[model samples]
Target: MNDSADYCDDFYNYVCGGFVNSTLIPDDKNSVNIFITLNDKVTKQLNTIISRPSQPDEPEIFKLAKSLYKICMDTNAIEEQGVKPLFDYVEQLGGWPVLKKDNEWDESLFNWKENIAQILENKFWVTGFFGFYQTIDIKNNTRRVIGLSDYNAGLARKNLIKGLEDKSVLNYFNYMVNMSVALGAEQEHAEEELKEALEFEIKLTNLTRPDEDYRDQTLAYNPMTLGDLAKRYPYFEWKKYFNYELSPSNISVDNDEIIIVSNPDYFDKLDELIDSTPKKTQANLLIWKEIRSLSGFLNKNIREVNGNYAKIRTGIIKGTPRWMKCTNTVSSTFSIATNALYVREYFKKESKDNVAVMIKNIHNQFIKLLNSTSWLDEETRINAIKKAEKINQFVAYPDELLNNSIINDYHKAFENFEMIGDSYLESSSNLDFFGNKIGWSELREKNVPNMWDSFATRSSTANAFYSSSENSIMLPAGILQGEFFNNELPKYMNYGAIGGVVGHEIMHAFDDQGKQYDADGNVFDWWSNSTNEQYKKKAQCIIDQYGNYTVKEINMNINGINTQGENIADNGGIKAVYLAYNDWSSNNELEKKLPGFNFNSRQMFWVAYANTWCSKSRLESQKLRLIYDNHSPSEFRVNGPLSNIEEFSTDFGCPIGSKMNPEKKCTIW
Candidate 1:
């Protein structure tokens, strides 16, 4: 798609430099777009329905997703049940003081905050300087809230507070000191106990709050209650930890349980670094974050020494293929009892009736971009068209995931679990203790909206989201297909690639933290103090124009107020699929030059939206997604919204101040 280059100087490297110079990037991927090439064709169509064949009247969710994909492709029953079930679950949680031996130490029978609240209620990987979970209460949206917060650290929070003296966070603690000497320790006591567990996660990244200062969704909502977080942080133990997870099921948190303190200055500098460190450096940083999140289900040399710091922060040499991480751990913990056999084998009802006519022509081109915007007013443009007619365009899968008595009553709500073909550390410890014991017995007897078993374990993700707390948008059938959706391309290249990703997730229901949630998805604030000060003065002119755009291939700079709500849904999703393809080519016709490209259908609709954000990455995964991605690079999500698109300089005519015709332009739909 070079076509003599210059689409007003840099149309995303002139149509993503021919698929970022014909793809490649893979040695187990660091980048390759079009949602990782249709999530590697939905992981080779769920590895042909997880290497089929076994069928004795199958269906108990495909025999538990083929016995958790043959217990993660039984590599000699995980190397003859090696790292002895991770050293017998670290000698029942009282050992790994980095391979002990120092006269069998015991800080008076250590409890390290009740084993860091049972390693964050049995999830394991939850890093230490705080993090508890159980969300959905971004401002009392009823039920579920928990939080505890502040944790990001495993490295990169500006290299644990040195704010970049770089050495890729000491080459990720020399790959966790070669995974604590491949789980045996003693290579100089595994490099001084993994450099004192990387200086206790650089003192919990200097006691928190640095994800671009918590992208202010109303100053990161606080809330508190478990007796005002034990009188606002009286050194841990929040009521024997939420009465050891809701008073053994009688479900009562004793001091009016509300717990939302979303980082009161990260518990006032983590109560001065847990009252000046050492109880053996907080028991070697919660036993090095539960033995580095259960050392990649142990064995194959502790999964390549816990996959060598994601191949030194994302060059990704290997990992994730133990039968696609046991078919993505049975498609993300039995996604509503395994996404109805991945939507009855690779979803398609003519691609959900042509993506429900492109989500009804991108919600009538976002009501003609809120009837051609004017910093919104007429009663905030009729409550933003009654919250875009109650958004909810779910798309690709979920129709109760093709209901087979709700996938056999969600696999008979885990009727007596079993994985006879044993070991992936006992099928990931019997599916993490019977999927949290039938997810707290169906969240204490029948809670609803079963996200098709969490979208059947991220069915090879080619994601699309919006949720707002269910105002909905979803999409996922792994982003439909290749260059983002297909039913045979042209309707302006599927309205410039998946109708500009269904108008960038229906313009993320009016961005900036989804305009503080509304249309029944609660957290209410339906605009109007002069349309919320002219929508924060047009979201501070797109946060001072993408915060003076920098990211020159990860040299870094673009946080733009924590990526201004996905750069306002990537400029109102390429102007709602370029005004829903000029209202469907004002009665259809325009498709002509893409075969041997000469760029015709309006420069092939911006080269199918910059070749669906073509590939290339790995400068250590673009400096670890420039400190953990929010989105802004993919060449500023296509030249920061086609340089404030005036129908992209009148269909590439440009001239009016070249460089894609910029002249103080930063709009917000």
Candidate 2:
């Protein structure tokens, strides 16, 4: 029998010598190679797990155990040494919950104003380090200019204060700052702890050197099981322990009673509009429109603001700068560009039919899932499904906004570039003064078409997101590739990975935050009081569950208040994906089995789903994410959901009363 310490040493050796050797390559110019290597290792491990049989051997389990063991070792090492100071400081300041409860604690009311002082000090530090402003050459149609850094700083500061006016937003900022400080401190501590743990573990074990392959030996020794891995590593064990009591219940499987409104024609018309236009012309039109839009805004405000510059500057410095970019073209242009690129590429693909099929299926699945929710009242469920069905699926991209004539027209309209810049600034001031009187129609008419080119270049990103305000889910071409989606791979893999991602995005419409918006993307109380209360109760359960997990020696504090929306989205996404898969399965689709893998197509689906999220983060990045990001760590995302999912447990034959299977599970939509 192997001693626990010996096991630890061997695991350490595998991580440093075998795993790192296999994944990481040293290069002088690129310091981030270690992170990349770790990411690759995680991806490879997930793939292996996915390919494993339903009843994996001790070897398979041990491999997973070893990987997780190393992860815990690395994480704990950082938490104890690097992040402890910040954690302690934040704890002393009052944990998030406590600080949040003190709503009436105003800086002016306090004797010393500790909270306000800390915030001001941190703001100064940030301004000093990052430098605050940028200047743009309004006349030359170029970004080059002086005073831009100050300008940008002023704008950033203004935005920050505006955000702070809302108590929730202010708290979020405070949380981010506190968390950032904590993460930075914790990273140093964790690194030192990891080095020491590695050294100690290495001294105890006999293993092959870093240069050699360990596949033969890995095959010889049966890898640790999940149970064994959790027991041996307290860090990993703690997550499972907490999850046992906190994991939310599975969503109901019956999705038949829901009303699904189908709009298979939305994308078709959008495609026809784009296909009729020439690509180069469309691209040129987009650029021309963007340039003109910027010029138009700058033309109006440059002079008016010049007169009030000192007063505006004072207000800005005092944390009360007015919103000056109500008529700004940058954000709108960016949205247009991103949307256009998405639309163009989508139409170009041979799988237009496939895209349509996916959208229709997503719509139908959401309707069914909403109707099946036992907790939601009939009226709420009906409205929720209506919202889901009403959601407009914009595929590929929007139609070209600029024609040659329109571009030329806008170009001629901006004869004096400097005046145009001043006019642009004036327009912003006017919008700020008037408030929503500028109207969406007038703004749309002035909008340009340059976003397509920008988006086409940035097409390789690996994620997709939903916008509650827009009631849209963007499926970029970048994430449409890889393990997530490939035309050649088996349907099960595609559905499990990419399809799962799509379903997840669709479900966001009904997640805690998204549900706040109605079908038309308006914020309104669409649910009954009883239903709303039930929803809150269910959401709170998820918050409590995730809040209990810790990262880097500090409790994650889950900010259930803040992250409840995202957690709900995640839970719903998984369920939506599963239901979408079932819908596909019912069509008598044939399952293809991979060679050397014991799992059938159904089992492989879950494995593929889990594999998509196998990733690692730097301690700093991880800490930042815990504070600012809505999603949980990737590990928790997989394990947390899998534990709640009976299907996953059943597929793996997870033992009853195992850490993964608790007696009570909290269920929500």
Compose the digit string of candidate 2's lDDT tens values, residues 490-591: 777877777777777887887776776777665566899999998778777887887776664334455555566666766777767777777787897677
Q: Over 4 Å off in model 1, which ranges? A: 1-61, 64-94, 98-102, 105-199, 203-283, 295-329, 333-340, 345-348, 351-353, 356-425, 429-475, 478-501, 505-540, 545-561, 585-665
Using TM-score, give the best candidate's number: 2
- The CA lDDT at 53 in model 2 is 35
Compared with the true structure, model 2 gives a TM-score of: 0.48
Flag clash pairs in model 1.
331-457, 332-457, 335-452, 335-453, 336-452, 336-453
C-alpha TM-scores of all predictions: 0.31, 0.48
RMSD of each: 24.3, 25.6
Q: Candidate 1, after superposition: displacement of residue 513 in Å?
A: 20
